[model samples]
Target: MKAAPAAQQELLRLQALDTRLAQLAHRLNALPQTAPLAELATRDDAVRRSRAEAVGVLEDAKTELGRIESDVRIVEARIARDGERLTQTSSLKDVQALEGELVSLKRRLSDLEDQELVVMEKVEGAEGAVAAIDDERAAIAVAQQSLEAERDEASAGIATEREQTDRDRAVVAATIPADLLAFYEQRRVRGGGVGAALLRQRTCGGCTITLTGSDLEAVRRAAPDDVVQCPECDRILVRTDESGI
Candidate 1:
């Protein structure tokens, strides 16, 4: 393929734009927040499970406390009724029977009150467990929010750079001959995003292999306007004063 020397050099500019675009894409995917965000997600899942277990414990403790409270109320009510009967009864036997029942009911109330105290402590402990889990969850949320913000800011900057680089690439590509540009585009796909490279100091810049013997002679015999490819990596070789051919 034949292209003006100036037009061939334009490939170097086009290649630079394409390389910058590729780097920006890679930066977007591998942002510093990406790994940390994934780790935060995993920690969040564990926290969610812990919170669920803590809530279940809290509910059980509350249910036990409720039962103890109800029992204490019933015993207190019985003691109050027996004390009233003892005061109102005129018969000694009735008074004695009411007194005995009052004593029993009071003892039962004391036992129920003790149980209530123990269960209340358990309820407090359960509540603390739930609260601790909540604090951890909140901390994770804050971290995730920060990371997301960082990712967004970094991604936005990379996106802007890529957009501008794309525009520059379009302009550079437009200055090349149609056939040459087409060939370069094909080479880019085949050469890992590098369509053209400067053959500096007898080295094929695309593959870093120094041309020798037959390969060196071929490039030397080619006209300045004749487009050439690096035999090693199949990329268009853009020659300049530093080519050392």
Candidate 2:
């Protein structure tokens, strides 16, 4: 392929713009807050799970408390009926039986009330646990929002730079001949974004391999307008005065 020396030099400028754009893309992806935001998401999920478990425990405790209260009500009703019967009965034996049942019913009510208190305590503890988890989730949400904002700000700055770089790349690319540009684009894809490299001293800048013997001799023989490729990496060689042919 043949391209003017000046055009070849423009290729390097185009490469610079492309490299800058790539760097900006990388910076956008690796914003400082991205990792922390990921961590915050994980923490938020855990807090949500804990809250769900705490709520389950709270509901169970409430149910148990309800059952105990119902049992106490039934026992109290039995005690009242038995006491009334003891007062109105004519037979002493009947009164004795009613009195004995009243005593048992009162004791059973006391036990039920005690059980209700323990369950109520459990409900309070479960509620506290849920509240703590909610607080943690809210904190995580705030942190995630902050990190996302920071990341978006950084990305916007990078996007601005990339836009300018794109304009610059278009200008430089327009200066390159169509066939030569196509050739460079192909090589750039193969070389991981480097299509052309400056040959400094005796080294192939693209692959950092020094040209020796026949490789160096061939480059020396090429015309000034000729587009020469690096033997090792196949990148177009853009020679300058500092190339040390």
Listed in order, each prediction's TM-score against the native is: 0.70, 0.78
Candidate closest to the true structure, highest TM-score: 2
Candidate 1: deviation at residue 132, Å? Answer: 2.6
Mind giving the per-residue lDDT tens digits that candidate 1 earns over 45-149?
A: 999999999999999999999998988888888888888777888999998888888888888888888889999999999999999999999999999999999
- How much does candidate 2 score in TM-score? 0.78
Tell how far residue 183 is off in model 1, in angstroms: 4.8
Across 34-140, the per-residue lDDT of candidate 2 in tens digits comes to 78888888878888888888899999988888888888888888888888888889998998888888888888888888888888899899889888888888888
Q: List the residue pairs that clash in candidate 1.
A: none
Error of 2 at 98 (Å): 4.3
